[model samples]
Structures are given as structure tokens and as C-alpha cells.
Target chain A: MSVTRAWAWLIALTATSTAVAAIGLSGRWLALVVLALAWAKAELILNRYLHLAQAPNIARGFALGLALFMLALTSLAVAIP
Target chain B: MTTPQASVLDDLPGDLMMWVLILSELAVFGAGLMGFLAVRLTDPPGFAEAQAHLHSTGAGINTLVLVTSGWLAALALEAARAGRRARLRALLAGAALLGGVFLFLKAQEYADLWAAGLTFESHAFYTFHMLLTGFHAAHVLAGILLLGLVGWLATPRAVEAGAAFWHMVDLVWVLLFPVVYLI
Candidate 1:
């Protein structure tokens, strides 16, 4: 994606995540949705901003690592009250 | 054997060592975040209460500021590669200024919380908050300096490496904000 386009999506996702919390949503679903958005934003930065797209394997590795981290965090968040 | 295909490493942008550094930094932050989550699991209600005192709105604004700065830094790299020194400098300066804006907003948030009597000892949540976000804030400060140095050098490689580091900073905040403030 173009840098500008990636940025627009980043802004949109950031707004969505922030508004989700601002609306006082809580619990498991909130953790799932918000962290999912965080995952997407991280992917965009890794691929477009960092230009990891040029190296597909490296990009996949970074994505996988981040995905695992996000999953663990989400699991912990959901496991909370 | 047929001629070896170009190494995947060859396609990776910037210095290989920079990517190594980025990966290491990501691992450290990821571990820190995981620890925060594990601790939050212990007393969810207490954690939520502490989290409520945070300024999510300011952090949200900082996320926007940071991503915009990363975009500018990316463009700076392109300008450097295209040999447009002036545009390169302009974009780098813009990115660094936005980084400054992020730091200013973060400082204001910290000050507000401090005045409200939320210190590291207030709760385990605040302790994690101060450490994780404080370390990330230090990175933003370093990134601004890196941008300035690379812009002065005006070398494509230098800018590429610098932009890579700046994006690492941006990416960390993207992950950190929700976990720390929102979630």
C-alpha cells in the first residue's frame, strides 16, 4: 500500500480503538476487538512503514511474532474479570 | 546448480543490523507488555480502576501524531533516495517535530496523573504504566535525535536506517497504547 493510504487506515483504526474504549465497553469482546485492531496497525507499520513487504519471508516472520504476542495479551485480558 | 536466486536478505530495506536492533527492541517491549497483562490478570478490578484514571484521549491523539510522523519519515527516505536533499530535510524535520508534539502531550498526561497522586507506588498497574510507557517515551526522544542526525547527513542509507528506527518507535506505541490505556 502507498504510505498515505496506510496512514489513513492507521488513523481510522486508532480512532475506532479509542472510541471503543471511550464508549465504556469492557470485558472479553472489548479485549478481542481492540487488540485485533492493534494487530492490524502493527502489520501496517511492519509492512508499509518499515518496508518489510520487500522481503516476504521477513514480513511473515514479524507478522507471526506480533500475532502471537497479541493473542497472548488478548487471552490474558479475557481471562481477567 | 542453477544460479542462486537473490537472497531474501538482499530485499530487506536498510541495514541488516537495523532490523536486528528492531527485532530486539520489539521482543523487549513484547515481554514487558506480556508481564503487564499477566499482572493485570491477578486483580482485574483493581487494574481497571487504575486504568480509568489514565488519559486515553491524550494517548489516542498521540497515536495519530506518531503514525503521521512515521509517514513523513518514510517519505523522507524516498526523498533521500531520489536525491532531493531539501525535501528530505523538510520531511525529516516534520517527522521530528511531530515526535516532539507526542512527547509534549505525554508529559502533560504524566504531569496530570502525578498531580492527582498516581505514582508508581499507587498500584501495580501504575508501576507497569510508568515503566512501559516511560521506556517507550525515551525511545521517541532518541528517534527525534536520530531523525535530526540523519537529515543532516542527507545520505539515503542513513535516512533509511533512521526511518526504520522511527517506525519501530511508532509500531511500539501502536501496540502499547491499547494495552496500557484502553484495554
Candidate 2:
């Protein structure tokens, strides 16, 4: 993707999260959506920003690490709650 | 222009040292977040109430601002790859300027907290709130300095390393905004 397109995605994703916050969902639902969006945004930056897409293995590692972090965060907040 | 040549591992960008720094920083922030979660779980009501007093709107806008800065840094990296020396410097400067804006907004938020007399000793929530964000803000400061240096130098490797660090700063805020303020 072009750099411009990548930036557009970044802005759009941030807007979604801001809207979600404004809407004021709480507890596990909020946790899930926010963390997931954080993961998505991080992934986009890893690929489009860092140009890690060229290094597929590294990108996958970062993606998996992000997924695990989000999962751990969600489980800690939601499952135990 | 730096071609973003893969490292010996063939899966990394920029210097291995920068990635190491990024991961180390993330680990530190991650540990802080885990501590925060533990505290919040113990006292959800107290934590949520404290969270309610925060300027979530400023944080939300800051998230956009920081991400936009990351986009600029990414464009700078692209410019480096394209051998556009002037564009690289310009984009890095823009990214650094946005970083300044992020700091300015955060300082406004901080001023309000100070005016309200909240401190590191105020409460468990505020303690972590200030600690984590304060540390992240320090990183942002470091990033802005690096961006300025790289922009001035206009060298590909410097630009790539600067972009890497700046993006790492942006990534942390993106993760922390919800954990610290909204959620």
C-alpha cells in the first residue's frame, strides 16, 4: 500500500477508537474492542510504517506477539472477572 | 537511500539495536500495565472512578495526533527508500512537530491534574496513571530529539532508526491510551 493509504488507515482506526470511547462502553466489551483495535493499528504500522511486510517472518512474530498480549490482557480482565 | 536491507536474521528493519531497545521498552511498559491491571482488578470501582476524572477526550485526540506522527515517520522512511533526501527531512520534521503537539496537549492535561493537586501519592490509580504516562512521555521526548537529529542529518540509516524509534513511541501510546485513560 502507498504511504498515503497507510496513513488514511491509521486515521480511520484512531477515529473508530475515539468514537468507541465517546460511546462509553464499559467492562469486558470495551476491553475487547479497544485491545483488538490496538492490535489492528499496531499490525498496520508494523507492515505499512515499519515496512516489516518485506520481512514476513519478523512481521508474523510481531503480529503473534501482539495477539498474545491482547489475549492475555482480555483474559485477565474478562475471563477472571 | 537506505533500502531497509534485512538484517542477518533477514526479518528485521533498521538496526538490531533499535529493535532491541523497542522490545525492552515494550517489556517495561508491559510490566507496568500488568501491575496496573492487578491493581484495577483488586479495586475496580475505585479505579474506574478515578478514570472518570481523566480527560479522555484529550487522550483520544492525542492518540490521533501520535498516530499521525507515526504516519509521517513512515512516509519519511519511504522517502528515504525513494532517495528523496529533501522529502525525508521534511517528513521527519513534520513528525517531530506532531510529537511536540502531542506533548503540548499532554502538558495541558498535566496542568489540570496539578491544579487539582493530584500527585504520585494521591491514590493507587493516579500513582500508576502518572507513572506509566510519565515514563511514556519521556520516551516521546527522546524520540523527538532523535527525529530532529535525523532530520538535520538527512541520512538514510539515521532516518530509518529515527522512524523506528518514533513508531515505537506511537505504538506504546496507542496501546496505553485505552488501558490508562479510556478503559
Candidate 3:
């Protein structure tokens, strides 16, 4: 993907996540949605910005680590009741 | 003979040491975020209350600033490779300018929080807020210096390494924003 396209998506995703929170939404579901958006933004930076997509192994490793962290975050969010 | 995988590894972009630094920074921020959540789990209401004091809108603006700065840095890399020294310097300046904007917004947010009587000693939430985001702010400072240095040098390798570090800053904020302000 082109850098411009990746940047546009990054802006859109940032807006969406910000809007979600601005709407006064709170709960595990909100955490899940926002955190998922965060992961997507990070992926765009990793691939399009950092050019990690050219290094598939390294890219995949970072993706896996981010996924696990997000999962743990979700679990913690759910448990926060 | 070198295997395909070995060749692919060798093909990784930029200096290998930059990747090492990127990985280390990510690990540190990731652990800090996880620690935040663990502490919040122990006192959800208190955490939520402290979080409410934060300026999420300003942080959201900072996110856009950082991402746009990252884009400029990426373009700067292209310009450097194309041997367009003037354009490379201009792009790096633009990216660094946005970094300045981000820092300005962050300082404003910090001032507001301070005025509101939120300090590191107030609670676990405020403490993490100070440490994690303060650490990140320090990185932005470093990244700006790196961008300036690379632009002055006008070398492709310097540009590549500098841009990589700038994007690392952007990537961390993308995650840290939600964890600290929104979530």
C-alpha cells in the first residue's frame, strides 16, 4: 500500500477510535473495539510506514506479539467490571 | 549456500541495529501498558475517575499529528534515496515540525492536568500516566533531534535510520493513546 493511503487510513482509524470514546461509551466491548483499531493502526505503521512488509518473518513476529498483548489487554478489560 | 530464508533476512531494510532498537522500545512500552491494565484491574473505579480528567481530544489530535509526521518521514526516505537532498531536508523538517506540534499539544494537556490537581503522587492511574507518556514524550524529543541530524547529513542511511525511529515513536503512540486516554 502507498504511504498516502496508509496515512489516510491511519487518520480515519484514529478518528473512529476517538469518536467511540467521545460518545461516552464504556465497557469491555468498547475496549475491544478501540484496542482492535489500535492494532490495525500499528499494523499500518509497521508495514506501510516502517516497510516491515518486505521482511515477512519480522513482520509476522511483530504482528503475533501485538496480537497477544491486545488479547491480554482485552482479558484485563473484561475482568475490570 | 545461503537459503532463501537467510537471503530474505539479509534483505531486511535499514540497519539491523535500528530494528533491534525498535524491538526493544516496543517491548518496553508494551510492558508498561500491561502493567497499567493490571493496576487498573485492582481499582477500576478509581482508574476510571482519573482517566476522566484526561483530555482525550487533545491526545486524539496528537495521534493525527504523529501519523502525518510519520508519513512525511517515509517520504523523506524516498527523497533521500532518489538523491533529492533539498526535498529530503524539507520533508524531514516538515515531519519534525509536526513532532513539535505534538509536543505542544502534550504540554498543554499536561498543564491542564496539573491545574486540575492531578499529579504522579495522586494515584496509580496518574502515576502511570506520567511515566508512560512522559517516557514517550522524551522519545519524540529524541526523534526530532534524529530527524534534524539526518537531514543535515543528507545521507540515505541516516535518513532511513532516522525515519525508522520516528515511525517507532508514532507506532507506540498509536497503542499508547487508547490504553491511556480512551480505554
Q: Return the TM-score for each candidate structure.
A: 0.96, 0.93, 0.96
- lDDT per residue for candidate 2 within A1-78, as digits (tens), equals 876787788788878887887886877888888888888888887787778888888888888888888777767667
| Per-model DockQ against the true two-chain complex | 0.86, 0.65, 0.81
Q: What overall lDDT goes with each candidate model?
A: 0.93, 0.85, 0.93
Which of the two candidates, 2 or 3, achieves a greater TM-score against the reference? Answer: 3
What DockQ does candidate 2 score?
Answer: 0.65
The CAPRI-style docking tier of model 3 reads high
Per-residue lDDT of model 2, residues B13-125, tens digit only: 78889999989998889888878887888888888878887899899889889988998888888788799989988888899999999999988888988898877787799
Point to the candidate with the largest DockQ: 1
Model 3 Cα lDDT, one tens digit per residue, B63-94: 99999999999999999999999999999999
DockQ for candidate 1: 0.86
For residues A1-81, could you state the per-residue lDDT of candidate 3 as single tens digits? 999999999999999999998887788878989999999999999999999898898888878988898898778777875
The C-alpha local distance difference test score for the whole of candidate 3 amounts to 0.93
C-alpha displacement of B92 in model 3, angstroms? 0.5
What proportion of the true contacts does each candidate reproduce?
0.89, 0.57, 0.82
